[model samples]
Target: FFFVACETHRARAMQDRYVLVLVGVIIITFLTFHQEICKAPFMPHLTDPEPPPLPPMLMQSKRQLLPDMDAEAPPATDVPSPTDPAPQLPPDPPPTGALLPLGPSLLLYKPTTAPMWDPTFVPRWQHLVSIPIMRSRHSMRLLDLCITSILYMTPYPKFDVLIMLDPPSRALIRKSFLEGRLEALNAQYLMVPDPIYVDDFYTGKYWWVDWPMLTQYKKVLYIDNDVLINADLNDMFDAYDMEGGGHIYAAQEGEFWRMWKSTPMFGLTWYKKTDYDRMNAKGIQSFNAGILMFVPDQIFVTNILEMRKWMLKWMEREIPHFTDQSFVNHWFNTRLLSKSILHKIQLFPEHRSYPGKILLHWCASFGTPASVKYDKMSSYLTTFIEPRLPKRYASRDAMVAGLLRPQMVIAEVGCFTGNFSQVLLETQPKELHLIDWFKGQGSGSDADGGTVVKLPGDQALQMLQDRFASSPQVNIHRNNSLHALAALQDRSLDAVYLDGDRGYDWLMQDMLLASAKVKPGGWIMGHDFYTYDRVTNKKAEKSLNPDVEKTVNAFLQASGLKIYAVGLDKQTSFAIRLMHPVFWFK
Candidate 1:
């Protein structure tokens, strides 16, 4: 019975062993399959949604989820939207052109190639930019004398006048003119503190004007109050013709240049701060404060201030010959390297005047009365003297004689007197448009006293009314010709006459505007064609027969308007118009 029991136990142990072996084999097989599946490369399942939720069948089968540790997932195939921020692009290269170095030290050369021509060219070649280095003592008499000389001598009607005055001289009046005359000329004035010459340095009460003038005009022909200008300055503007150059063109000391060619005073010298320093070190040149054109940049201004301080410190040491003038000449000689720029320096020849083309400088030695009485001075003053007042064109006689014909509308510009309108009235024109600035009242009034109707609150309207109050038939417009022309309807007038301000720019502006108002083939006439030489004072030797030559030439060149007839009245030359030529008028 014991043998049989032991055999039964052995049998039971064998059965248990068999079952354990079988289970181990099955587990190994499942793990091997899972390892194989995880190691396999993945193919994108584009058609499936949510990646099949991690395979529930594998979890139920008791398989390992990831047996292999080496493989990577495939990269994404779809790109991001273009609207997303992109990487920055590289910058473009710079353009290729000729380059130039700038500063006062460098001498610039004009290029051989011709400069592009500009129609509105003013000769700035010889133009002098003056800066007055004023001391405390204001020189009002000198200032007046210089200003009067400028006014009398300048040939051009307009100038950019800069007056740097001391703060104290703000209320002082430089010009003695009637109230009406002052308004006619548009002049700009400014006042600032003088840096070089302070108020406490000198007790001369007259120094206030000098300080003011120096402070106001940065780039000017700073004339000492005692000096006089007696030449036409148009040549000065010609200096701008130089292709490439620097600032501070000056006149040479003729006497000095004649003595020594290689000497520092060979010609007018231009010096900046560096040049000034070099000159002081080498003892070459000095500064001149007399009639000069100052190039007013920050560097130059600072240098000027420094130079002024140096001068004051050495005032006791240096025996003053010409005061600042000799110093200036010395400064130019020491600093300026190349004498090529000095080619423009024109000296006052012994027989000929200094600034023969532009100005005459009458120093203090001449005395005020003698200076004023000089032949050049007399001639200068006579140029601006107004001629005898012109006689009025008789309105009734003109109309009766068929000099004036009835038209759809009569347009008269620059109606100094309403004589033309008066003539138009006799012909009973349907409309009369009179345009003028009317500088003089009653100067252009007609016999009938029917001129422009002045309206209140109209800036332009008031001007026309004040000037043309005598002419009842004429309707006055105070606005600029360009503005008036823009307001008019097409073919609004039958006849148009223009005689406003005399300037190429002004004439052109008026002509462009008037062309729009006149009907096709309508009459257009102008005045002052024959008065150029008379107006410019260029007719001393030549006869004053500029009526057709000057004005008509300019008018034709400007507007291509043909001259129909030259009506020879007693004093005035009147131009009648032909039909607007198709080729030329436009």
Candidate 2:
């Protein structure tokens, strides 16, 4: 019985130990689960540090973090958050590949902004303004005085002035006019030191310095210091805007036309750099550096520099005409693109105007000192020093006469006075067609003492009536000679004289009219045929009018008109119809 009780106590003690170990294991497992739950929210901190406050996105785009969920999600149309790596877009199919090849590495990037330029883009027109440039030396008092007079006398309101001068001279100009009484005008003075390397007259270097100011303004009016701006330039400035960009605009240099054939190298010549060098190698004339409008751009600036260099070289080589203006004309004619900008500013007519003028130059071609003195004395002594007379004739008479002539008729092609017309009126015909492109009121009465019948109908007809009034027997029809000739029966007119000195075009028109109207043995005469003016001598290379030699020769050959007699003193040449040709049938 003692052995049995000892065995039972050992068994009970072993069973109690097993139960305590199981309870300790269960408590440890519960503590581990509670710690894991507390650390769940902190898992984000262990990852990237707040993921760099998502980059700024474009406004007006609805972005969503969770696209599928209804409550937390943005609208269905919302664009995906750019921060959330965008889905890889399909690769652009290679030109040679049949389909887009699968690739392990593919990245998609969205454009941030639209392209700067596009093929379909249209440009808007911009309003442009221009300033005239007047550059002068301090020593040229005549230029300064004239310019100052022009500024004061102009009827228009103040316009922008870009004055380029020596520093001291610039200051003096500003003090005298810009800052003083004439400050009301918008004027900017640019001071530039006289170039040490280039002589002023030879290289026209001063003009190059003024280019910077010209570029700043849309259009630049370049006037010589000797110019007299009698009229308001608002019309000229308004005309500039009509010239589109990348063009060189200029006033119709009437003087240039008169001398163009002689100096084929006169005026602005535009050229690409490569071509300019080629031209220089060939020793061709490029551009005219005198009064001109240049567009400030890379090509232009480069061309100007190249041109100046060439001119300097020419000066070094002892070219006869050392003037920069001459070089400029040479360059433009030789190198500039055919499509380059050329507009004729016809304020001044070369035939009448002096050396430099916007409107009318009193004495352009003064010969020897003695001749100049005589002209000056004559001008001063003349009773009619009136500016109004010339203006009236030029503006009203010239324009009116041009309008009245027939479409095919050639009216006064040259300057004709009343006395000259009366000489023709001595042999009166049934009907007289007097065409004067520029006809003024009669200064002297006709020899016949007949009252002048100044018609006020079509300008062309009025011109004829006014001209033939000396012969009361002749009925006058003032209209375009072309239109008048068209109405008349073939070979009906007794005489036709095309004396207008406009240009070759007018001369040709006159030939056409004379050929049609004149009967057998009818007389035809033209003025200014033999007269050689000195103004034409200086600018022979850039003359506007064709060489009278060539014009007369060509017309004589083409029209088959026989030369009757050359005038004794004047530049007049007369011709007569030998036989009326059957041109109408042809």
Candidate 3:
């Protein structure tokens, strides 16, 4: 009975122990499930990531509001339905000053604000003139001056210049006169065949024999390179077209029949001594072939095809001094006799002949040395021609003279009336480029505080050309400032003066381009840098440009450059010196 009682006790004890173990296991499982699934607020776990640290206060986007569920819904048409696609807004524009990546390592900043230059712009020209350039240096110089005079003084802008030359002469002109590029002069070249070598004058004059070959043009005016056209030649051309019926009209030689007296007439089988007597008695004389208006088609029947044959067969030899003048005079005289007319055929009236009432011809071969004639021409250009034109404004140019030194390569980007350019010239720069669109200006305050009258662009252009035409150092570019600035080679200028477009973008572009073009240690300068009031930074009376100061400061800051100097003139000017090599932003 005692053993059975003990076994019963042991079994009961074992069951109680199993029940405790089962209860403990159930509690552990409940805790694990609660922690994993419920994640209670009060319960902390090792795996739970700390709530993401609050975002930066300023960077955090505003919280979008959810529609209130309890609020009364608006009319269906008032708001878009929840299922409808969201409205789209345009993406914002990219920043203006974003750095343009140059390469893997380098980045540059170029302005995207300014309008790019038009690369396709070309002036359409109408009138054309043929200017014959000789192989000699003296003649080339004369040609240059002649071109300058015609461009500046003619008062007409439609004329296109054509250079008549042979291969050797063309090469010579290209090397010496054109600096190895014919396009520099903006002229076309016409090749002459088997050019005559003359000691006295250029053989280009003889090209009249081949005028018929120039089938492209109906009428052509021939002017010597030594002549400076002071007035319009259109009237002369018009007169010839109206009065000269398929014939030539020319200025008479200074000495009338005396020039043709020694010519051989015996070679003309159809001519008689009486014809010569009648011609001399009637005051009939050969015209100076230097300047002629001729119909190219009229001479097609006479010696037009064979160049060498005409010279050998018809040339008068009694006066051994041979020239195109003698040949044309002899040839045309015979043509005139066939038509039974003497003075009426070729001679222009006395008013247009000899002393040249309209234009000046420096008959260089007539007893004067070519060098002497050139000097005289230069003197006449500066002293006589320049003084005759009006000075549009009071002098503000003297102030800039102090900034420039002799023989510097200088460019004035916006020269008006050449007032500042005159001072630049006085400094004797090796080359001075005067650039302007010459698009006219309204009445404005002058340097002396007087109101100047309105000026037209054409008149302004004419004035600028007249004022500077005599100066070999002055080169005028009638173009947009952007176009002109871009045409310059980078790092080629010693200094660039900007008084061009005053708009913020334009000023910035000009400054940037000028900075790029200037050599290291060179200056970039501009006008109207400050207001007349000098303080308040506002556009004061007489201060035409309000954006100059801001644009200049911005450019200086960007380029890491500083203002070197400022002018003391009433209309203030500023200058920047580039100390180091510039790596211009894109």
lDDT of 2 by residue, 83-194 (tens): 2333233233234322110111111112222212123322221111222222332223433333433433332233455444443454455444333312323334444433
lDDT of each: 0.40, 0.39, 0.53
Q: What clash count does candidate 2 reach?
A: 77
Order the candidate numbers by lDDT, best to worst: 3, 1, 2
For model 3, how does the per-residue alpha-carbon lDDT over 106-140 read when each residue is reduced to its tens digit? 22222234222223334234334666655555666
Task: Tell me each candidate's TM-score.
Answer: 0.36, 0.32, 0.43
Tens digit of per-residue lDDT, candidate 1, span 1-586: 3543555566577877665555567667879999977754232211123222322322332113222212332122111112223223212212421111111111111122221222333332223333232322234334444454443344232334434444333333423221111212222333333222111121111222332223333344555444445443434455433321223434444433233223332222223344445544553422223455544444444445444433332232222223355344543354342122323233331234343345444442211343343444445333422111111243224422333355457777766545455555666777788775533332332223224344233444454466557656568776566666667786677667665665666675565556566654355555544422334533233323343345456666655444433333322334333223222344
Local error of candidate 2 at 494, Å? 65
lDDT of 1 at 229: 50
- Stretch of 10 with least lDDT, candidate 1: 99-108
Q: How far is candidate 2 from the true structure (C-alpha RMSD, Å)?
A: 33.1
Best by TM-score: 3
For residue 296, give model 2's deviation from the true position in Å.
3.0
Q: What residue runs in model 2 are displaced by over 4 Å at the alpha carbon?
A: 1-140, 149-158, 171-184, 195-198, 201-213, 240-246, 251-289, 337-586
